[model samples]
Target: MTSDEEAFRRMVRGSEAAFAELFDRHSGAVYRYSWGLAESRDEVADIVQETFLVLWRRRKEIRLAGHSVLPWLLVCCRNTAYNHNRARRRSPAGELTEPKPGTHAWHRRVEQEQAVEELAWVREEIAALPDTERRLCDLCLIEGLSYDEAASALGISPSAARKRIQRARGKLRAAKTANL
Candidate 1:
């Protein structure tokens, strides 16, 4: 059997067969991971497709971790799931059928609305942060980048990235408490 690293190298060199081999080997694991993060089967399928699309588009830039491409693919899957969920949260809520008053469904709907309102308030707080801190939150908190990755992207030290993210969280927590 060809190793993942060798297959990935061939894929990067523009071999469609190698790319297919990698996809065939890892797509199941990616799909399973997507299911854990996504809410519905359709969403899971979308996430899996986006993950592989990302892998193909960024093939030249990706490096196998620990001699396997699965880790990178899984990370891409997670990031895709997060992006999907975040976009769904930010979009206007669809027309909800009103459940009978005093029923469990009605109560659940009310709770979901309250949660959405809280998420909006939190987004506002993040938006109010200093420019650098806001970027830090978007990268490290929202997009799930590691401190080192965020730091490199932001042209700062990892320690500074960590501190900024911590400070941003503290401010957000304080703001929430004050509002309550």
Candidate 2:
């Protein structure tokens, strides 16, 4: 079986079959994820379609988050849903009604937005790190690789990987605390 990375490479080269295979493999997950953010079934469907279309359009520019593209696709789906909701808000007909303040839905939306903001902050901090530390964080933290696995991939000792990840965590913690 071709790995998603390999399939993605083929898709980047304009292989429609590889693109279709990727869509087949990931669209269901994207749809379910969209449902969480979309206001209705029809909106979820539109978000899912838009997400994949954006992927196809930007295939040459996207980098896989690990061995797979699912993570990237999920982020794309989220952004598309956000855009869809924003457009609805601006529409003259006002298709999207704002959830009442203090309501459960409003609270949930606030929590979700906060989570997204924190994730973006962490990503920015990781990007600002030294090259080796950034790659280690990407593999061991974001990609969920075991220390030994990440160490092997980076050609470092497992203990060294552990220490670097610990240092990275400290830096991230301090940065976040400073922001707070």
Candidate 3:
């Protein structure tokens, strides 16, 4: 192994100085990777911090693996960014423009009200779905399973899983069009 790889292994085993060396050697590459995805400095910084935090938490497993760290780090960054985006989407402020300091509080309140109403409508629509379709959606989409995986989990065949997902999607699209 190269000296840098050896140092990274040490760092993952909790060597503070080795961790510093690892950071110095790779933080620029990580930051650039985050910047490419997030575009916002704050979000990029969050992704970097999350990536390292996860690395530290999983250090033991990391030390056992003989693969290059860069690809693992990149995947970690991407996962972190995706998770952050999903969380931000769930926030009330996510859909609205950043409020100016001088903007009226009432205007912000109105925006929040509209967002809540939209969320309620979405919830109702989802709740209105047939139980089978709803369950399929929960397994395949929310749980992030492939059709084959979802089928195994749901005790169905892969073709059945695919058909269920397609039917569910069609139902949702029809509901959306009807609502519009």
- Best candidate, lDDT-wise? 2
Q: Each candidate's TM vs. the true structure?
A: 0.51, 0.54, 0.47
Task: Tell me the lDDT of candidate 2.
Answer: 0.87
Q: Is candidate 1 or candidate 3 better by lDDT?
A: 1
- In order, candidate lDDTs are 0.86, 0.87, 0.74
lDDT, candidate 3, residue 93? 51
Residue-level lDDT of model 1, residues 42-61, one tens digit each, is: 68989998998898899999
| Candidate scoring better on lDDT of 1 and 2 | 2
Clashing pairs in 1: none
Task: Estimate the overall C-alpha local distance difference test score of candidate 3.
Answer: 0.74
Report each candidate's C-alpha RMSD, comma-separated, in the order given: 14.1, 10.9, 15.6
| Candidate 2 residue lDDT tens string, 63-132 | 8879999999999999999998888778735366989999999999999999999988998999898887
TM-score of 1: 0.51
